[model samples]
Target chain A: MRSLSVPSSPVRDLLALTSRPEVISFAGGLPAPELFDLDGLRAAADRALTRRTLQYAPTEGDADLREQVAARLTARGLPTRPDELLITTGSQQALTLVVTALLEPGSVVAVEEPTYLAALQCFHLAGARVVAVPGDERGIDPVALAEVVERDRPELLYLVPTFANPTGRTLDAERRAEVLRVAERSGLRVLEDDPYSELRYRGDAVPALAASSDLVLHLGTFSKIGAPGLRVGWLRAPEELMPALVVTKQAADLHTSAFDQAVVADYLRESDLDAHVRRLCATYRERRDALVGALAAVLPEGAVRTDPDGGMFVWVRLPGEVDAAVVLRRALERDVAFVPGASFYAGEPDRATMRLSFTTGAPEVIREGVRRLGEVL
Target chain B: MRSLSVPSSPVRDLLALTSRPEVISFAGGLPAPELFDLDGLRAAADRALTRRTLQYAPTEGDADLREQVAARLTARGLPTRPDELLITTGSQQALTLVVTALLEPGSVVAVEEPTYLAALQCFHLAGARVVAVPGDERGIDPVALAEVVERDRPELLYLVPTFANPTGRTLDAERRAEVLRVAERSGLRVLEDDPYSELRYRGDAVPALAASSDLVLHLGTFSKIGAPGLRVGWLRAPEELMPALVVTKQAADLHTSAFDQAVVADYLRESDLDAHVRRLCATYRERRDALVGALAAVLPEGAVRTDPDGGMFVWVRLPGEVDAAVVLRRALERDVAFVPGASFYAGEPDRATMRLSFTTGAPEVIREGVRRLGEVL
Candidate 1:
């Protein structure tokens, strides 16, 4: 049980090889460093470096930061009050807090078949019984979700409804409504992890599940748009759940760093975050096209990949019985790398699957990395 | 079980009253804001504002920061290596991680009576059985601890051996050895939470419990000396524990903020933390003296408080059956505040006990606040 908590995935082992500067790795879901607004953050730091910024803050979070996030979330179609939000180290921590607050040991949790790996780790740590709801192009299949919910009596249904990690698939608006209905009928709560919504390149934005349902615990992060290193994120939870979440959060880290929260709030007030996100979307859109176009041009005839409209990843399925780990090994020999999709799944893995991330590289660089991958294939 | 996790302590209730501008609050264990090295930190932040500072870092923590912490711990008597430590949000999170890594649900954890409130909260969150080992002013009694270990067979013995929070009592050198012997006899691991050793205002330092026992998981933090707002701390553990600790920490917050870690590293590198600590110690000494002297002169005959040599708090036992909450209400009316000590205990209430913090208020302000308490008495 102890060792199982630590990931020994072939993908993680292979990722170690991609650290060489020569490897134009499409492995990590890291945001483009060139896009981080250093000047704006520096100015924010200047404004935030007060005595109050160095003291212990309220357990809930910095009031002004919550207000800023509340305003932004409200502007984004989800009406949120400051008190309704809990600022976290990152949305990752927000997920951990939710799992801790809502689930008891051995409680059932239903997640997408191939969900975020770290979320799986959180559920694992909590001793949760995780059942995967099968899905296809439009994210979690509502029929399967309802079946899983009714059979397992899952306390929570976790989703990445928009541009999800690993998959880069947004649940279609129709499916989102169906999923909510399934949840409502089964009395299952949904955790909407929305880290990639703002990174959309081409698709029109869908209203978040939380926009229609208070039962949804909506999670968001500055890691994608602001800066990952700052490690600032938040969860907008139903008021009924706030007390337990607060208690769990307090037990977790007291609160997110006061200095980071203050700086983020100041940056939001002073800088053009919308413009910065627009620039990011523009660049990522190009990179996404480059990876998609390159994969289409190079891979074997039976090989298939998702041409995601937005977000970091492009999920791929290789020709019959082809192991992604074997492909990863060959790619690394050529100084190229990507994660084996098997690592992302909660249930039995499809050994033929792999994920390619596009956000870290320039379009040309991503094309070249895929070009090397084609040699391996 | 859910509501039990949320603290509804009368002290927390009364603390709201002390937030008014007129009140002089020693209710929180906050570091002195005036003492924060703003210029040094600003310079550090200036040096730390690289693209990497805003990018996601290794889950274990930044390499440079761990090395700096390793060096500091080595210099302070306990030999440490960078690899042996895991960087955390604060020692608070360190406690949480240790609990997650070591204890299972219903695992027995023996803590010093009137332990830090948040530590109890973490144990409660994990569903651990917490038993308090009774002690006097010299901290946890080794014989009583041995009895608890023999009878309860607690998997862990948690202590803040050096200048503990709330109590501010340092376990004497003799007792430290006895406790180590007790731990060895029982095969029980000790978590020495030593956040305040550097803030010592008087007396020669005792070697940390970690210095004598490899079984000790030593927790230290920058919150008191550097700044709480940064939320930086570390835990030094045995090699066997690192894998589980790292995994738990990764799931906790994806490592503490990368920017905060880098800035703290740069600050530690460029600045003389020892000299800053010395300056802090000097000032806190006077404040400690003022609170102690004032209490001696004015408190009614049966009232007693520890004359702590170091740390943030001074634990007091008011005259028999005089509820600390009742005293707090009267003191709040006088615009003064302290935490009622019953809140810190896990086993049973000590209605006559309370904790007064000397770190937050200046000597003159502390004396004035104590004078107001005298009026209420």
Candidate 2:
């Protein structure tokens, strides 16, 4: 048989470095299942198993679920209609649809430096050049973004305004408005990814960047709040973009699973998702405090760690000479794991930084893991 | 906000003309949901709910279901391993992974002239130009494929080997082997789409082209036999290609819904899927026969219809002057529907052809729809 050279994913090459069994991966931006509403999901699935719910549903999504999502977003102060919402396989697929519909080969997309790796991968696959804007713990630096927007004339900018992956930082409300204003002035559309917004452990809820920007494409998912197993997520875009997204989604997976949608809808209807969110906040806050306290106590002086108010991750910067990738291997030898900070950057990766997740392990496990990390250091 | 002009899907312009509610959509290659195993699905969902199977599962799929799918394939004389399979949101996403991982911008792909529209959409989205090879009712003509292979030196050939969409055509054993041989000699990879393979209403089972071609990436789905709403499908690729696919899938939706995968796995293990297939065949056979019989009785003198041994669709060609799109509008005006032929082609679609799906509606509905179509003619 002849050997045809198949093209490979640019992102896939990085995956092999992180796929070891002994690696306690903080690399994957996966929701910790210990925090999932398994009881509610079970009840919802039981309810959905009835004869009426087992058949094919509308390709758009189950009507009741779409309405619930819309209502929830409306309550969050965003103007949304049920018809405007599209349920997707995940927020990941939603991003894929956005990229597929709005991006062409060689299109310029401005993203946050050290943004979500998956989003970067999606844009790369869609044949877009990912131009990064410098961001801090408060999210995208409006001045830097404005400079890049004026310089590169990018078509879109992607950001996570609340508790971003790899860096558990939220963009402040002032910066949010500034970013929106800049986008309005510069003609750049923003893709506001807010999956970690609901998992906030401290402070009051902040309005999403989408609420402020008319040009924003808001992506949300149930993966963090409820269950990742269902792979249910939604996108709320402007009228002009919805049709294109629908068509792109139709060509992607027909639509998200109807069974999963129906079950999630049923779960939302009967359960107090807000209350579940509160419980998640309490538990994750405890875990977060444990890790932060342990790191402070165990790590050497000058090993800076991000003090995130909420979300699953903590970004840490080590001494300039200590590469995180090498540290990760040493930590694994001591039976601990984390994602190297270099994996998160679009262009110039930081070898001295790493991300630690507080959601996956228990408080006891967190302490032990940190102690092991201290020994490695 | 400034209107951003990103390059759109080339097929998007064509989609507007095709999505009219009044059009008899032979354009959408949707499975006949009437044949789905709703009872078994309901039972499985109920059982899974009781077992609390709504939590996150391994990214590959639920273990029992993978084992069951493997066992079932093995029973059919095809060797498979549970680890070798990756459950996808649908066969569409499965194909998307293959395209994303293998095709680069401007890569050459060979496809059937009248291919599955979604496959064309996928390849186009991946930034590859599709070269069409002429095909007859028995699937892609091997001699024509060989000629195209020699001329274009394409990277991949995509085909629907059994009960193909829009055509309801199956490749005989000899043709299957010949096509595999051609692919081997030419060093071309083949993507064998077999979603409709199990919906056969008559005749003995034909060996899959994958069994013959080691280069084949075989895709299977539960939509035709089980439920489209479940969105459960699997792709069997060679070991060398599996990692890239897994990485692509991880970037796509993390994985297909673990809840849905669990239910499907449980359903496949606990229920008699073969018995369900038998039931589907019996009902669909009647529906297919109804449309075939009605067309024989009512079609215009010069019109020709396919006599498919199995599958839900029957392709029909009208007289030279009659365009199927016009006929479709007229049929829908009379409260009937079918898809126009032009939507299926990757290049120039046949304006004189149309496809009628018999299994989506009842025999009486099928007869009435065909009668209205004939009247329009």
Candidate 3:
């Protein structure tokens, strides 16, 4: 018998090393736990623990939760209906479900060069061939995307277009339209994963790619805004794909946790999610500023980093010949950590790059973490 | 692009029809909602709603919950370590993880003739070729299992040994040993699904197959005893398989809900689960007797039925020339429902068979539902 043969994650292994309490680590993609609404969530759980909430729910999702999600998406400029969405364990499960519904083994998929590592792993587990579409400071390079699409004939193109993970790059309106045009011309489908859109600290929200094209599948998660421990997310797809996705979801796990879904729905109804998000943005923005300012002052003259408008990460490109992995080893010796960017690639390695997450620490703590990294460098 | 090609479940679709308030459905495999420990669970949730429980946790699972699950399994006769277990989203997700970890596309798997339908769908979704091993009254026939393994050269054997779905037959101790012997000789892996073992109303407990063989992967769930809405389950596997299973679990949904896991752990610590289960057994046993007795008094002469010692369902075979599906249509018209047993078979279906669940109603209500079913027949 043969197995799926997924490679052990280097990033996850590295994160484990940084988990020691003594280490000031920027290696994890986790939300700040201090920001969670404990009392609000506890109240929601109290109200939601009823006979209806304790029963097996529909495979699509809890209808009230779906309606709540749909309404929020519509308010954000993406017109959605409850029927168009399928609740998932997290947006991570949404990626797996999408792959199950849309791609087969050996089918070609295009992903951004250094995309979300978990998404790359999902595609590989499904036995799909991944082709990388190079990106620039402005996010995915439309010309490069077109070239890759023409060459590889990929069935699906995966993007994290709004305040993306690891890189924290947002595609401008013009760039998003150009990417969609390329996909449309090539008859390709796009999966727009927008988990960090609502985490924006400064910029106005951009319309989702799904709002403009029926071919795009949209994914959103409450992990960043509500709580990751709930494991709740949703996928919005075109009408044609829902049947297969629902069937695949039922086979995958029957459904996501009904009690969690009910609690989330009640929380949305009885609490101020917008106010909660604003508080998160206020704290995270300060942390981000601290990390970026500290990095600029310490790094060598040739080094460059993306100063994102929002999101959790600041992607840094070290000076020429300065390998990030080597730096990470030395940094670990000083109880400081960041992820070497090579682990996020779907194609060629970039050894002189790294990703730092600023969400888990305060401004002072983040500055302290970067100070330790500065000494290692 | 190609989808996984899993067919929509006929049973799930049939269940949607049975959901009307007027219908008395023995079609669902749902635990009684009133039996849930609402207050106890709410208290647990209140305590578990902490910063730790609201953040991303280890993909392997919460260490505390694993320790508790391990201790319970150890007390029940299977010696286990916390590290040997992986928490999943219900045991349903456990089936998907096992399929991903062990079976590649086109690998052969052996299952009982009329097995858990969802398991069949999961195997098929992974492109595995499933072959059915016929069973008699005492669960899977060891002789038939040996012949199928020898002929088909299946890599794995799946059995719901104690109080199985569709047919609540339990494997006797002698038959369990024989099945393990055949598996050992053939170098076959066995998946011992024991979801309903804790709900026993009569008979002595049988040792899990994992107790006797390291090759057996044991699956258990809190769905039956606690609540399915929590979607908490665990799988115990050999050390050789744990790495792949952990990796697969990470790729599946990062991990099961940390909030739910923490609540379940706290509930187990703070509440008396044995007493709750005993209460469930007492009620369900009376309902089972009522359903069985009613069927015996009403079914046509020559019809045969299984009087299960414990668990949710009782399988029935009507007299000659009967079609269970046709009877279901007539029964539904009278606001009474059951699952036609043909949907459970992996091989040829028996048109005369049907499955009735007794856990959803009181004894008087169960008798009334069966009386309506009698009129339709």
Q: Rank the candidates by DockQ, best first.
A: 3, 1, 2
TM-score of 1: 0.98
lDDT of 1 by residue, B116-188 (tens): 8888878887889999999888889999998898899998988989888779999999999999999998789
Q: Per-candidate TM vs. native?
A: 0.98, 0.91, 0.99
Q: What is the Cα-based TM-score of model 3?
A: 0.99
Give stretches of model 3 more than 4 Å off.
Answer: B3-5
Using DockQ as the measure, which candidate wins? 3
- Order the candidate numbers by lDDT, best to worst: 3, 1, 2
Which residue pairs show collisions in model 2?
B24-B338, B25-B338, B25-B339, B26-B338, B26-B339
Q: Using DockQ as the measure, name the better of candidate 2 and candidate 3.
A: 3
Residue B193 displacement (Å), model 3: 1.0
Error at B34, model 3, angstroms: 0.8
- Residue B293's lDDT within candidate 1 is 92
lDDT of 3 by residue, B204-294 (tens): 9999999999889999998999999999999999988888888888888999999999999998888999889899999998989999999
User: What is the clash count of model 1?
Assistant: 0
User: What is the alpha-carbon lDDT for the whole of candidate 2?
Assistant: 0.79
